[model samples]
Target: MQYYARIDRSCIRPAKDRQVTKRTAAEMDISSSIDNETTHKARSEGATRLNSLVASIYIFRLLFLAVCAAVRIQLDNGRYLVVFKGYPFYEKRAVRKGTAVICSCTRAQCNSYIHVDRDLNVVHEEIHHSHEPTRLIPLSNGRYCRSSNLPQMEFIEMANGKVCLYIDRYTFYQRSPRVWYCTNNVKCRSYTALSPDMRPLRMKIDHCHPPPKLLLNIFMTQRGKERLVYHDYTYYKQSRTRNGFRWGCTKNRWHRCKAYLHLADDLTIVRSNMEHTHSPHGTPLYK
Candidate 1:
């Protein structure tokens, strides 16, 4: 008896069907990977765009702040002013608990005004004008004045070869290319603002003390020798050096005074010791 091997057809798949199944699975995987890559690319592009937008906003904000600073100016008298377009406005009143200020046109008849916040942002404005805009000239002292009222400025050469700004009777020394401080900067808050060309823009003439006075006087003695008179006290030459001369008080011998002074060849007081044991003799004849 010829017996054929038992074949289980249900356990076997066609080669074509198996191949089709494997191809379908691989296609699905490729499609899923393509989708994942597309999603990741999209996210990356979005993040890049967001960063660029933020940077642009930051730059714009900086530019806005610069513009605000240019418009709002503080005067040397502690007053604030706002310049819009070509017109100038003075502070009229403050509202919102001093957080906001209302500025009015300089012209009395004009109804134009602006409301500015503490940050100098103009929140409200009425820019109507009744007359021509007032022209203002910036001063070296961080103040502004009418163009027609600009003062004449003078430049003087100091003894040490440094140049100083002289306006009225006050003197200012250069502190920077665009600013000058009062000669008495220690106690004075005065200063002058200068333009790029070193022209005086504004001046603050507030001085804490009066101008310095010359207190040392040169006197000729009967022996044709030179003597120094300071504050009614007389000083005679004690010794000489290359840089200067040392002087002793006239009463050094009798009163044993220890006071002395070092005077330069240019008559400049280099150093001094004024511990006198006695009072000044009399009024200086030279003075």
Candidate 2:
């Protein structure tokens, strides 16, 4: 009875293992099919979105180009003026005031417009012209004229805030070759031409010979030996006396302090201490 039971149990084990293997294989197939379907759906959705975005962009670009084609620009007077579609009133006022204004302009409108009048009309019959004559000012770069014939030019404001002409040149004025004779002294002549803007050039003491240099001299004695110091308005570069003594950077140079000496350095104490001890002015020394 035991041998028969063992043979039946062994036969049942093989059948059960085969059924488990079949179930696992079927589950794997179903999972793979679901994953494939999900991947296909995701890819289709992504493609549709991408196509829609590209189509929208194309439409927007086309609309923008069409709008741009409808707008144009125009010039008025000497200034290049443009007719603004939106806020037309503001733009007109800005143009009249010579102020900058922005307007919605398009490329097609820009090309379609043509300049009717090349010349600027100041008034009807008077034909308002530039009152100032064309001035040819020599520049470091080259010669330039106030007329529009020059390559680079611009409107400049004067000190009074009035309109003036400006050129894109380095130096505007040149050294006039004409020699101006001094009315006071016929012998004297000047090469530097003063501007017409200032008062008439007058003969001054500086025009004399010896070109005004600092008298670097020193003095020791009080009589005829006293050095005549020719000092201009500038304090630092003052001419020194001839008697081997003058106002130097240090107090050691001046034998007698012409002015009240400030105690600037330790060396300044030399003269002060000696003057105090000896009573140099014959005044009674302070106790």
lDDT tens digits, residue span 1-287, model 1: 89899999998999999999999999999999999999999999999999999999999998876654328666545677788767779888999898888989978789998888877788888778978876665655556667555444456555566666654445678888888888888899888787886555666656788654325765454356766667656688999967999999978887778899999999888999987887664223231
The local lDDT score (0 to 100) that residue 257 gets in candidate 1 is 82
Best by lDDT: 1
State the TM-score for model 1. Answer: 0.39
The candidate that achieves the highest TM-score relative to the unseen native structure: 1
lDDT of 2 at 178: 29
lDDT of 2 by residue, 168-257 (tens): 211112223322222223343321232354211221111333222322222222122322222211111123233222232322233332
Q: Point out the worst 10-residue segment of candidate 1 by lDDT.
A: 278-287
lDDT of each: 0.74, 0.31
Off by over 4 Å in 2: 1-13, 71-287
The regions of model 1 sitting more than 4 angstroms off are: 1-49, 61-87, 90-103, 108-111, 114-124, 128-152, 158-161, 184-189, 199-205, 212-287
For the record, the alpha-carbon RMSD of candidate 2 to the native fold, in angstroms, is 27.3
